[model samples]
Target: MVWRSILLLSMINLLLLFSSPPLRAEAASTSTVRPEFARKGALTCMKCHDDAAITQILLTPHAVKGDADTPFGQHDCESCHGASPEHVHSRPPEGALRDPPTVRFSGPHPSSLAERNAVCLGCHENGQAIHWTGSKHANNEVACTACHTVHIQKDPVLVRDRQATVCFSCHTEQRAQSFKPSHHPVREGKVICSDCHNPHGTGQDMMLVKDRINDTCYKCHAEKRGPFLFEHAPVREDCTLCHNPHGSTKPALLTLGVPWLCQECHDGGTHAGNPYNASKIFGNTLVAPAPQAMARGCLNCHLQIHGSNNPSAPFFTR
Candidate 1:
């Protein structure tokens, strides 16, 4: 009986092994490595590129040969520029784009947008670029090279102070807004575009850093996030309902004057539509304090505009 049990276990192991799929071997690289470009020309990168020229890429991390991930380490120039045997040997026909080196970024006859991005994504697909294929930037056909300069020691877009200029090139409306009197500190460089946005691509709309607008605002304004008994409805819904995120002419970036802004929603009862005049402020000593028209308006009584934890302050009047 013991021998029969052992035989049964052996058969089960064999069945399990056969049922599992075999592991796939890595595919052989299709890119041909051409050493002849360096050897036949008897040239280094500086020979053709010159010290003050594009060969300044050597100053960047891409030129570090010890790191296997970079282009220079992998296939020298041909890693990014495709193996162009013909480019090295002879010139093309007249009027034909004859600039040697397989990948040309900026020229009269540059590589197509897809081809250029493909070269980048080939190595970067596993990094921050993993979601790039379906992202808004990708959908709009925005190339990776559009915002990045790989050959330089320092890309201006990567720096905080200079990054806004890069984004403002396409987002002209935002540039105008940032110039308004009531604006975020983008010009001062205290707040940058990347602080609220992720250009690489996020699941949220507008490439926002957070999934919700209020959540993004609460990153700095945590006092407004509350579970109070008396909550302002619009405050819970969206900040943009009352405030302009970019910039505004009014204080606190308010979309409109207080009573008018409040009247947009709360148009009811006697004083709701009342306009402020000389009589409302300095005219008469009436029963209650004069209608709140001059100072702070609705906020004079409704101090808890965001929310109220007070049990007696249902209208947030306290």
Candidate 2:
């Protein structure tokens, strides 16, 4: 009976050895089949990603097949998304999610931030994006896809009317300010955030399109850009000193109403120091109230408040 048991064990071992070789061969064959670029390019991707949002990319400039600089001209979707033969061909285990593409822009399991941005920089590394390497957005790990939507007919960030909405997603404070009584006509679609700012990057502070705040303001307020005989020191230094470019409760986007705003800097002797109050109103005071306390306040006399080209108007009152 012991000899029979030993013989049975030996047969079992031989059966296991014979079965293991096929398993090893199968594993080796699978490993050797590396992921590669799909032969049909966007056609292959369209088989799975046939939704309106994904297919809308065909209408964008990036899909111009005639232009070799474009994605569709190169390897279509694969140019930006990278090769994904494994994702295209393989099936996930039962009840498990399928493997993602090699470089997903937006999803639950996206590629590394650097990897996502690297794909964009590979093509858009020139022009406005030249300084993007050391830019505030890049340093903060802000992805290119954060502001740009590639799989769309028109990228909202690139559109003048809808641009601020894209920027307001991250700049919530600016959105609140934009709704204030006084603003830069941003909501009216007459002005846009990109008019003053360069989201890609800039060598200037606040990522302003121009080198200085005053210069940026001058883009629209060209009349203020003057070589006047009398120049307002604060106006020349920075527009933001007296003005809130985003928005304000005061008229003309002024940081404060008239005398209050002027008093911030001109708080010295004379009427400039006197605070305008209800007590100094026409009926409340025994003495005639100062003109600085009335309608338009400091601007009542100082008509050319920005600057006066008139040689005699030393106080910017032309």
Best by TM-score: 2
lDDT string for model 2 (106-224, tens) is 87888999999999999888977988988899999999999999988899888888988988999999999999998878866789998998988897888899988888888888989
TM-score of 2: 0.84
Expressed as tens digits, the lDDT of each residue in 1-318 for candidate 1 is 676446444533442343222111112322353444443121334344543346446557776555679875565566677666666655778887554567777777778899889988888988877778788999999999889887777877888888888889898998998888899888666788888888888778888889999998998888989987999999999999999888888888889988889889875444555544334434564425445665888788888888899999998886
Error of 1 at 273 (Å): 4.0
After superposition, candidate 1 runs with Cα above 4 Å error: 1-43, 51-53, 91-98, 275-290
For model 2 the local lDDT of residue 64 reads 69
Q: How far is candidate 1 from the true structure (C-alpha RMSD, Å)?
A: 15.2
Off by over 4 Å in 2: 1-35, 275-286
Global lDDT scores for all candidate models: 0.72, 0.80
In order of listing, the candidates' clash counts read 0, 0
List of clashing residue pairs for candidate 1: none
TM-score of each: 0.77, 0.84
